[model samples]
Structure formats: C-alpha cells, structure tokens
Target: MRLHPVVSLALTGLVALATGARAESWNSVTVSWTAPGDDGMTGVASAFDLRYSTSPITAASFGSATRWTSTPAPAAPGTTQSVTVTGLLPSTTYYFAIETADEVPNWSSISNVVSRTTSPMPDAVRPAPLTVAVTSVTDSSASLGWTAVGDDSLNGTVSSYDIRYSTSPITATSWSGATQVTGEPLPAAPGTPQSCTVRGLSREVTYFFAARAVDDAGNLSALSNVPSVTTLDSMPPGPITNLSVGFVWLGWHSSLAIRPRSAEARGR
Candidate 1:
C-alpha cells in the first residue's frame, strides 16, 4: 500500500535560503520537510510560512516565533522542501516549524517542530598564535609582515585581524590599552603571507606590535609574538642658523668685534 497525504516536517542538514542568509559561506543547518496536506497538500499550495526560535516552538506560541518569509513555493504533495537559517550564534540550539496555504489563503496547522544546534569552536580548536614582525621603519611609519593563520589552527581563514602597538611590549593583559591599528589587512588563507604599514608614528621612538585572529563564531586566537622597531632619527639638523663670532678683550683696547649670536638667526 502507498499513501502520501503530505505530513513530514523535520530538520535535515541540507539547506536552501528563504530570503536572508549567508549560506554561501556558512554551509550550516537547514530545515527539511514534506509538504503537509492538513490544509491543502493534494492541491497546489499558494505559499509557505517557516518560523524558528531559540526555544521550543509550539502551536500556542507560533504567532510570536520568528518567521522566515520568502519561503520556497511548495511543489505537489509529498515533495520535500528545505531552507537554511543563517546568522545564528555558535553552540546554540534552534527550533523550527512550517505551515502552508491554498489559493484561498487557508493556512495549515503548524507542522511538527524540529531542532538544531550550531557547532561551537570547530573541532574544539583555536587558531595558533600569528607570527608577526616589523619589516621596516622610517622617521614616521613602520611596515609589518606576518604569516596568516587559520580560524581553527590553519583550517579556515580568520574573519579579522586584531593588530595593535604600544611604546612598551604588547600582551593579553594590556591589549585593550594599546593603540589599535586602523585599516589592518584582511586575513588571508592560512600559511599565506600578509602585511600592513602603520603610519603617523613619532620619529626616533620604538614601538612594539602584536596581532591575533578572530573567527566568525566569535572565538579569539592567542596573542602573537611581539616584535618591535625604532623609527629612524629625525631629519638631519637644519642648516646652521647662528654663525656670528665673539671676542673677549680688555676695556683699554678700542677694537671693533662681532657680537656673539645668542638666539637662533632667521634668514636675513
């Protein structure tokens, strides 16, 4: 005997976006279901309404649950459908349910609720400390280079770089007080080389710099080994300004002498 009246709403790894998501990069959780006929699955359903939440989803609370609009159009009865819910925190569980309607706008009962939990730190790992070094320096700027590290120990590119510098050494305890560099280069693939130039530094001063990586899941990496460089001394002394001569003599002698220059001389 074969019977398919349409009643299968559940969570399957496969994903398709309803309207909003970053599925292209996230390859994460998705909801799968067979169109329900409680309202009208034997006939072509007009639309689908998918909703989800952090807690258990039920018929009584369906109205307040978050709705995922722009859901895919329903196929004939028994055809499976799915959607990828995006922008969720790591290590958290989510509940989902769906309903359908006919051309007359008669909606079906909320399907069975399904649940999924996002992965926390992928593989329970953190990125290795990045290796950064000051490559060059001038009177007012310094260039740095480092080998890029992955989000989870060289597995995936990190989401961002936390680069900072200070007159003293940079460390986890003092990271917040260090001056954060603006326009840090975006993270590259693990083992790839990356660099950035920090400008507007004071001449003849030494600066210690460090960096760390952050993953999309919000996990932070260890602080990098600190490297430092002293900027070149200020530009050569300006052209000689006061060059007049001076002489010390007894009052008895009537002799004309040049006055010693006491203050910086201006271009005359």
Candidate 2:
C-alpha cells in the first residue's frame, strides 16, 4: 500500500509474460512429416511432413528421412500428421524440418530449409480409367454415359467427370450432393463421347451410378465403382385377377375330385 519499486518490477514482468504463454510445452518431441509438391490439383493441398531438428534442444542429430502417410489421412482441426518423403537423395542437399503435435513444445516455426533438388520421379502419368455406362432408365430420367479418357497422360485433356451416387450400398465419404458429368474430348480410343440425363428422380426409385475422369489439372481417377439403376415404373400395373368368393362352389371344389360314383346312383 505504498511505493513503486519500478512499478513492482513492471507488474512482475507482466506476470511472467502471461505465465509463459500458459506453461507452454505439450511434448511429443518428434513425429511429423511434410513434402508438398504433387501438382495433382482438385483441392490442391499438396501434403507435408519431415522433421528432425529444432526443439527444446536434444535428440535427433540427423539419420532418417522420408516419411509421408496420407492415403486418406488429413482432416481434423486439420494436420493429422503427414509423410511423403520418397527416395529422397537425387541431388543431395536436404535439410528439412517441420514440427507440430498440434501443441507441445509449441513447435511450428522452423520451415525454411526447403531446398529440394530431386527430379527423376515424374513418370507417373495416369489418366485412363473412366468407362461408365447406364444409357437409360426412365421414371424420372437418368441416362448417363461415359467411355472417354484413353490415357491422355501428357496431351492433358479430359477435364471433367465426377458423378457419384449412393442409395446406400456404402462407400461415399460425402459428395454433399454429387452429380457432375462433363467429358467430351473424343476422336476415338475412348476419348470422345459423354452424355448426361439426370432429372427429378423418384418413381420406382433405386439408383446408383458411377463415373470418374478428371484431367486438366484436377486429377481424380479412382471412383468408378458403383454402377446401378432401377427406375422405371412410369405407369405399370395391369394384371392381377381372381378375387374369389364362393364362386361356383369354390371353382367346383377345386377342380372336382369328390366322387363315389354316387353308390350306384345312391340306391336308385
């Protein structure tokens, strides 16, 4: 209640910088990956992962490198570990680093060693596997067609086709409301011929069709495995009789079989 020793040491150094950013240190030490550069483009995030340096200072002098795992792993607060360091040693000059356990040791400030020089793994041009076909199905409409995309590896053309559906056979991670067919680059070799006919839909209902082919820098080919359709009842219902009711002694006691020859005409 009296005196300023330099204003109480500047309020005790602002309460030790807000308690050291809240007792920082979530510890995992090492377990991360990053190698961004795929250029497939569809949502383009190019994955990432590769760390072994910069922490509280200890462990990892440098010995192992090359780890990227994201077959279907990358979605959450978003950063569920990544690894894609394939055979790296081409031009030798590596010194990668990127640590982040979401919050531990509070690491995420050492990504400036991106000096890459490995070029000899770019012969993986896959773009030929989209031959879907349903042709027709009426009840509300649906006539999708596809058979184009014949290995356009470098010529690079295709550009559109990703129509998925699911009435519940399971295998649709969420398309929100998928139905996008736009492929028309043909001249033979399964490269030119596309069609679409999807309307209202809902009569006898029972649908499931599939298609996939996107190459113009969208790169998405591995989802043409759910072809099915059953929608045609526009007006079908005419054939069902025999109501029955006594009807001639139930149709002659079920086609007659009750005979005793009337015991000689029942004793005359």
Candidate 3:
C-alpha cells in the first residue's frame, strides 16, 4: 500500500517504542544475605536473574534456578535472613540463585549464584535428665514419683514424660527393655506430675528408675541417670533359749507328742 512518508515514519516509531518498552528497563539492583547456621550465609538478590547449579556455571545456565513465580520472594535485598531447609540430604551441597524479573524482558539475567552445604545432624538429644523419686517402699514393691523435663525447643515447654522402670538397674544401654510404667501428659498448662507404684519384684532385689521428656514433636531427651533401690528384707525369729531339764522331762511325760530330747540325740 502506498502511504505518506510522515505516516510511515510515525508507525515505525510506535512499533520501536513498544518493542523497547516490552524488553528491558527495570534496572533496580540489590543484594541481601541470610545465614542458615554459623557456617554459611545466603544472598538474597534483587534486580538480577539467579540460577543455581552444583557444577560450575555459564551464562544463563543453572542446575536449578529459583522459581520466583512459585517460590516466595526473598527477604529485603542487602539484608541477611536466617532459614533452615528441612528434609535436606545430609552433607549435600546445594546451589541457589537470586534474580530480578523485569517486566520489559522475557527473562532477566541472574545477579549472583551462591552455594552452600548442609550440616550433618547429630544423634537426637537424649531425654533431659529428670528426677524420679521413691515416695514409698514396701517389702515387695515401691512407689515412684517424677516430674517432667523442660523442652528447650518449645521455650521450656513440656509435652509429656515417659516413666520407665526395670527390676535391674537402668542404664542407657540396658533401658531398652525397661517397662514404660507411665506416660504423664502435659496439657497446655504443663507441670503435671507422674506417680506410680511398681510391683512383682523380688524382695531385696534392687530396681532402677528413670524418666524422659517427649515434646509434642516426638523429640525424646536423653535418659536420666539411673536411680536404684533395694526391697526390704525382714529377718526371721530368734532361736529358742536353754531350759531346765526337770521341766523338759515333765513336759515330755505329760505329752509324748511334745517330748524333748537331748541335742546330741536329736542330731543323731
């Protein structure tokens, strides 16, 4: 179609401006950091596209890139925020990218790529040390009492206490088979007690006692130190004393069934 020169130029200019406006122009740049632990920190990037990879990177190449649309926005740029990623493989290295998405461009360039390795978790903490006291003791059994341990995770809140006992002494290794005597529940108020008597132990046999605190999350504290006690052992009556020979003979004469004999004869 034939058109005037001004008209053609005006159309071209409009197209160019539209294309440029759609492509680049968001130039705000910022960086922030976060520490998962004492070991490392993560940089929260802004105004830049981020791509992460376990291996060395090249332009626009990321082993894994932050899915900004799906992932939550990183905290304010140039600031560090602490976060712990749970269920991460132990001792594995992970790479991350921080980037900004400019409305003008199809995809923005990544600003900085930071990599960090997760720490290996230690064995779960043993139930906190607790004191289980014996309130009463009988010839055959004893009554025990205990208080719950404070959970540090919940700001010193306690969820429950596991009351364990064994006729044998309680040790970390030996307590595996110990009977769980009581499970004292800690309501929101907390500070509830657990008391129960243990029976079926042999007289004079020492039994050990211990308790463990379990938070609502099922984290168990270390087993407390073993406390032990022995059952009562009552002695038998004393032996008979010496008596007159005449009285003994008279008693024997009166009742043949009740007759008494000399020690040597009886022994023979």
Task: Name the best candidate (by TM-score).
Answer: 1
- Weakest ten-residue segment in model 1 by summed lDDT: 18-27
Root-mean-square deviation (CA) per prediction: 16.8, 24.0, 20.4
> Per-prediction count of colliding residue pairs?
0, 18, 13
TM-score of 3: 0.41
Tens-place lDDT digits, model 3, residues 159-218? 676777787777778777898864344523234466767776678778888877776546
107-157, model 2: which lDDT tens digit per residue? 233344433333322223556666577888888877877756644652556
Model 3 residue 262 CA deviation in Å: 51
lDDT of 1 by residue, 159-217 (tens): 99988999998889999999999999888889999999999999999899998888885
- Candidate numbers sorted by TM-score from highest down: 1, 3, 2
> How close to the true structure is residue 139 of candidate 2, measured as C-alpha lDDT?
88
Off by over 4 Å in 3: 1-127, 153-156, 182-194, 233-268
Please give the lDDT score for candidate 1. 0.78
Model 2, residue 82: what's the lDDT?
A: 36
Off by over 4 Å in 2: 1-134, 138-143, 150-164, 168-190, 194-203, 206-208, 214-230, 234-268
Candidate 1 segments whose C-alpha is farther than 4 A from its true place: 1-124, 244-268
